[model samples]
Target: MILFKKKPWKLVTITSTLIFIIFVVLVMASIIIQISNYKFDKSQAKRNEYIISTSLLNSGLSFEVAKGDINGIESIINDYLSYKEIHAIEVRKLTREVIYRKQKTINKELRIVAKTYSLLSQYDEISIDGLDKVENKEVKTIAKVVITFSSNYMNKKITQQALFTGGLLFIAVMITIFFLYLFNRYIYKYLNNIINTMNSIKQGDNITLKNKGIYRVEELNAIYRSLQELSETIYKRDAQLKDSLNQAMEAKILAQEAEQFKEDFIRAISHDIKTPVGVIINLISMIVEQSDTIKDNPSLSEKVNACYESSIVLKEIMTELFNFEEFEQQKLIENKTKVNLNEIFSQIKSLYETKFSEKGLGFSVYKGSQQTTQLLYYINIDKGKLLLVLENLLDNALKFTESGAISITWIVKKDSLLIQIKDSGIGIPEDKYKVIFNKHIQLNNISTSTHQGRGLGLFYVKRIIDLLGAEITLSSKVDIGSVFKINIPITSTMSTNTENTLLLTEELSKSNFKALIIDDDQHTCFTLTEMLNKYGIETASENIPEIGLSQMTKESFDLAFIDFHMPNLSGDVIMKKLTSTLPKNTTFYVCITAESSPYHLEKLDTLFHEVLEKPFDITDLQAVLQKALKSKRVTNEVINNIKGKS
Candidate 1:
């Protein structure tokens, strides 16, 4: 409404007023010139006719006198009158000496009379028409005839003059208007287009023009040139601004990537350092335990164990930090396959029985009513990695929980398997429940239980859950308990199962088994061989898979420990070659370099019977060796566990 009340209406008014003024000026000037010319033509025609009539009458009289028609002057006049060319003629004897007068009469009373008849003499006429000199001189020869030549010529002259003058005036006006129209079309419209383009620029739209031809106007053409330059400048500036914005955005993304990389690097280093330190502390504790067995040393044992426990706590913290870092980096791998949570839970329960019994904590498992022995487990996950996450959670729960029940439940939600682990430990602070799954974070309010950890169990659990694209939530109250719920999407496919179960075919328990160990690192091979020798397995080292394979072919070895990553060949190749040569009854253990790769274990199942992750403890290695020793007499359940799903 405001715009309508503003410049548009004003512009319309000015343009219309200018057109009206030009039209009126042109038309009025044309009319005035035509009227003046009409009046002038009438007056000029009357004067011309008067002079011609007076001259003709005087010349006729002079011709009669020169021919000596003194007495017959009237007769000569009458004879000319018969031609009807001279309107009337009169010859009078004036001063008794044949002075002649010729009068061309008009309207019988008004005449153009000439008194001097000589051929070279001048004649004059007055407005009072009677001849004064001939009136007193006599009527010796007098004949007067009248002819009038009035034909409205003055009116006709005025009409023709008006038409000619008006036509010329109209032509002048038309030419002026045509040039004016051309000026508006070429000059005015060009200027207006420039003005409109400027307005569009001010409003931030692309500027362009339709140039029909070069403008005749100097000012308008100059403005057109200037506008083109301005448009180019504006376009270039806009492009530069867009480029600057893009650069800033790219810089921002690069900075964020660098920051995330730094966090992940720190986390990985911390985890790497902590694992070895934990191993050293646990080894020292084991040594102290052995020394205590030979002598009474409770204080020393407790001190050494406490040191070992501290190292375990540090290891947990570092592991959780690493998991969080990987989660943030989106680098955590999810090796999804169906898993039997019941089978997993059963093992956990059995492992925790001794610990729970010592702590006076009741632990039990209630199998669900589902009739499927295989449990129809369809979970997408890395089974070993997930189990580690659950192991940490359960370990923390059991440690904190003295004289209270720890339970594991598997309930079905829509299209999901919801696993719940609840404990009756000194519960978490309600406010801290949300933060409990973060690395290095601990609950300050739980002061009753003598549990120790780096507060990383739940964090690793959350990371594993996230990697699986699952959901986990925590609920707790002070002095009551905490419940952790995990939901994983389930399908109908069977999961790959890999568990070591073995039976001895012969009674050769006391026989010393020779073992060959191959690893790139000398310290790793020596340490592993020394630990195995104490377990009654005599061991040797090749330090590389190729040499180990060459040595194994030459020597009749009972078993081979091949590192998954070696200088000469990968453990998979060694396992493949060994299984091709050795009998199916023979056992091979493939040692892994890192715990992150579950596919390696699945691959190992194709050749070897057992696969151990690096930095395995003495007890874990002892269990693997025992299983290998009893491989020939394994039960169906044991075989099924060892042979992963194809």
Candidate 2:
């Protein structure tokens, strides 16, 4: 077999070729031997004929012929003819006279003739008869003999020898070929098996060769044993790796579960802490709002204001703590609502105007051109997150600035809002701009300032900006001022008059607008009732959701404030039951919650018409009332339109 034609150095091919050449040589040698033997046999037969003729002359056969003794010649010839090879013999004198002749019948075509000549002479005796003696004897030709030999015997002998040699050579060659075939098959079988095993290994099969018998060749057997050992080692290693991987996966699941438990614990603690904190802050805020009563006592007002400020700060710290954990976990929920930039701007102005004046710093807000103001800047955005980002930036500015002016400028472009907060304070280095946005990173030069913080303000701002898909860049020089420019992409916009036309007058108080407050916390119910009563809206408070539901069924209220978490029934469950039976578009349901968890808040957002986070002041309450009033007006308008059509 031609295993590899390109590489002729293979052992089997070389050996087979050599054997074939040897076989051809042996065949040629046999033919040469046959030819040489045939010639040798023919030559031997000619030599025998010559010897016979010469012996006759030596025995004086030629003299016998001269004496006319034909019988003697005939007897000698007859003796020679007794041999089978000599077919015929003839004797004649020198003058061509036949002395004696003998022949045997043989195949004429199978006979070969040979000729022999003999000379005869007589020597004179010295003195026995006293005759003349001659020193030199006279030589004379007496007779010649011709013999015919049969070639058939020589031909048969040569053929038999040739046939014998050829038969032996053929047998030897066949035996050699058979042996070579066995050797080739044996080598190929093991070699192919080794190659197949290697290929299987390459294909990721752990094939064990232990069951296969050892090879006769020591080298091949050793390699096979090594392969078996390697396969076993690989299998063991794979099992170990799989076990390790399974353990690692189990550990990872445990770690995730622990992390979830930690998050839940933090959320539960925040809820418990924030509920009372919200109540305290709101109650203090109401006390602080009673300015007429406290204005006469400066000492009392100052202490109350200090307490109010401290509580506000504590609330802010708690909020930041919760926000940090939520942002770290990437679990901050985004709730987008239609908001007015003017209102947000007004809030910011109200919050920071007094603080900046106390610091002996100039504060100014530029709201762009008159045309920009005329177009209602109503945009869909997460209002709380945006406020957080702005507050962080402004707080950072207020903290860093000593006595310089701080200015805020905002403008509306085609489909985006751009705001810039510029502060004439200690500026940041160019290299530190990007680094300052990382959590817990601060400028080293400014680390000793009295207003130094945990370095979370800008980081929080960056996280909120990124969450809102907005862009903020800072430009600053040392000892100069810094300007932070922010560009927020607006997904949607509206151009309309967003002014609140609802006026709170005696007519509105007599309008018979009623609101329901359902909360498991009596303090929250009382707070909400007091806030609603200020708007001249009649309020009924229920601590139990079941009682609230029963009250709701008996009387229809224009507005209902429901707490998210309750003992018997949750806010969502109550809302679901009431929404089915209550008149649609008549009652506005608001969910009040102290829980800061995004999961719970997201669920409540889906179930409630409005979600009011706790710790809100009169401004927040006023906003909710305005919305309820707007909704009631729309419902009344729709009803009147239907009645008129009918």
Tens-place lDDT digits, model 2, residues 1-646:
3233543443344445576768767786877777787878778765665566545545556666777777887877788888767878888677777667778874645546565666556533434333445655566566677776665556676778877877877787687778678767876888898899888776657787853433344456777888878767777787788899999999999999999898878767776667677777777777777667777889988888777777777777888888898888888777777777877888789778878999999998889783365665667788778888888888899988887899999887887889999999888999898998999987887888576788898998998888788899999997797999999988656555544323542434756788899988888878777777767888999998898998998988888998877887988999889878774647888998877667887788777778888666665676677677777778889999999999
- Provide the lowest-lDDT 10-residue window in model 1: 499-508
Cα RMSD of all models vs. native, in order, equals 15.7, 12.8
lDDT of 1 at 637: 52
Tens digit of lDDT per residue, candidate 1, span 438-487?
87777675433555566667777777777677888888776687788888
* lDDT against the true structure, each candidate: 0.60, 0.77
| lDDT, model 2 | 0.77
Q: What ranges in model 1 sit over 4 Å off? A: 1-296, 336-384, 388-419, 423-463, 466-481, 487-516, 530-538, 543-591, 595-646
lDDT of 2 at 607: 79
